[model samples]
Target: MSNQEENINLPLVHKGKVRNVYDFNGNYLIVASDRISAFDWVIPTLIPNKGKVLHKLSMFWFDFVKDIVPNHIITGNFEEFPAELKKYEYLRDRSMIVKKANRVDIECIIRGYLAGSGWKEYQKSKTVCGIKLPDGLQESSKLPQPIFTPSSKEENGKHDENISFEETVKRTGKDTAEKLQELSISLYKKVADYALTKGIILADTKLEFGFYDGHLILIDEIFTPDSSRFWEVEKYAQGVSQDSLDKQYVRDYLEKIKWDKSSPAPELPKDIVEKTLEKYTDAYEKLTGRKF
Candidate 1:
């Protein structure tokens, strides 16, 4: 519910595309609203409970993936949250109180399947992010294995440009880039495999990492629909676009409507919003094996 607004009462630190980060002394309180964005533009409407779905799902992963790498999450528990924020019951499940990290400026992406821009790139050049792929791979085709594909993290309203492994080294130094590459792929592989048990195909996901107390820790949201493509296992097919439990559905609707992805993005229809909510909630329940 925060754009670029700065109010003295809130001590807002940064407002990204969908998250409002408030500086809570040394720590930070990140609040995700029900804002749904597509084509890099926040649409005209909001989806009820969308933020909670994302927030809770991320909390589940922070704990689930901690053995791979430590994270920035302090707690999403209401009692453990800051005293000032505890008064609002709505924020209890939808807000995360996290430790501040020296934010990394890279998007650590890992792809286990051909989809989205990767599919488009492969169709024309038989490559993705400058990496050559085998011949005859179709859309949504599984990769030989998970590949690390890092991108330059862009500022709000700017598109992130995919960069090569060499470029990642140049931007963040060889040592840090290597860590990001190793950690991203390992986490993706582990989680992608685990997701299969939940009856979901983890096509790929984006992650952000940063230095916390001299240790590289995973930061930002991990494995949420907004960050990952969650395809239903039964609906997956090699040559066809798989049914997704993610924001891809919204993008599909937008594509069908032929809406120019400029400002004044069209408001999503009620059915579209309802379907998205169902997908989000379903993903949460299945992945966590807990009631949403």
Candidate 2:
């Protein structure tokens, strides 16, 4: 992303990994940037048009699932944008005005397959976040059924720690915990089933919930490549890591180079950036059935 955003007139409320959120009167303006992060470090280089790709894909999924759950989006229309963003032509499709809500502090993650932290924990204990699985599960192996794994919401630099289901009930009330877990799994199943028709496997994804108007609402990005592990369906196999179309593409490259994953990450090569864009674009197109 460019430094041009400094000239925009808005009260920046939160600067996340790839999205810069600003307060919009009673709402919020989330601007998706081309910034790519690997190992929790936002890289020095960017994939072209990545911001719009992610933002557009998120918009698509939000509409597709709005019937299943309430979301925070107001509209992506420029006409509905506040006067502050009216003069900023660059904030067109990459930005959205959303109603702000009292955010739930728990990270609601649902896993349909063994990968990432779930895989690591399963490798040692045959369980994921205290949820036991059948024996003989391998890396990239699909779980017998989807499972809810809750985690604590951490600061930008800190890793999110997984907590057991019982512990989640302790943190959030038992009712809220049950609601989150049930909603998360249902949402995951719906999206995962849709992705299968598109020839993409929705391995797992995280959802953030917030209480709005005394009800739970889904917030933040949903099922985008940035927030989910998407593997090409044709290449998926048990006992082997599958080729992916999400940020895992960049993670794999970073792992290969052994960059130590600390702050001030090494610059990405031009080819890497191009490949990353290809994956992100492909995911958007496949999921939404629209040209990226």
Candidate 3:
């Protein structure tokens, strides 16, 4: 459903691909459902506990990275939630009550490797998002240094176009743009290094930020299976796709299908869904050092 249509019943604020956000007076309640998407489209089946898993993962990261950057989470107290959602107490870990703010209109992306859309751009013009890369870089190859790649935060169903840092400055003002880039790179480096010690490689990730009284705070989800590419450190090899604990199974299944990616998405088989769930669980366990 379109975001506006989905907002009609509840005090819905924003509905993204996998989560439904609701506004209750001054506080906001973000609900993570069982929704699963492939190739930017929501598939029919649901992954059990997928919402809770993502919520817990983000909560864990927010705590881990809080020392480096502040977040917008207010509370996840189930007992204090409004009576309207009393039945969903089980989802306490899957949702959060946060102080909503004016979220910036740019997606702060940090890339430490050449892959995905970045790889495609490099193939065409030896650049990704208007930033030129060095010569002789292979697919999935690590760059000499991580770079901050910013993009316009398009609405749901629209594409997010990558733009240069100067363009980002034009849109978000010079100071805000500079601050987002600095914080993005810092958070990515710290988290990536921590993940390395745990045997997982954070290939690249995107972060969403919002402003509360002129202070930039990390909002939305952070470093989950959906937001970041998590690969096995031992399988790290340049010039090829690495085995991942993220959405590799889903992408592989989609590749096997004969359906054109442009058209409506094809349905995934049960085995594919089950395997994807396992990967998500594995990633959570590895990152948090706790069983999902």
TM-score of each: 0.96, 0.96, 0.93
Poorest 10 consecutive residues by lDDT, candidate 3: 1-10
lDDT by residue for model 3 over 2-89, one digit each (tens)?
3433433558778788898887768788878777776677777777778878998998999999987789888766766767766655
Q: lDDT tens digits, residues 1-292, model 1?
A: 5432232246878877677888887898888778888888888788888988899899889998899999998888777876677666667677888889998899999999999999999999999999999999999999998888888888867888999999999989999999999999999988998999999999999999989999999988899998999988888889988889999999999999999777578989999999999998999998989998
Candidate lDDT (C-alpha), each: 0.88, 0.89, 0.84
Per-residue alpha-carbon lDDT of candidate 2 for residues 4-55, written as tens digits (9 for 90 to 100): 6787778899998899999877899989988988777889897778889888
Model 1: residues with Cα > 4 Å off, grouped in runs: 2-8
Best by lDDT: 2
Which residue pairs show collisions in model 1?
Answer: none
Model 3 error, position 87 (Å): 2.9
Better of 2 and 3 by lDDT: 2
Candidate 3's C-alpha runs over 4 A off are 1-9, 77-84
TM-score of 2: 0.96
* Deviation of model 3 at 31, angstroms: 0.9
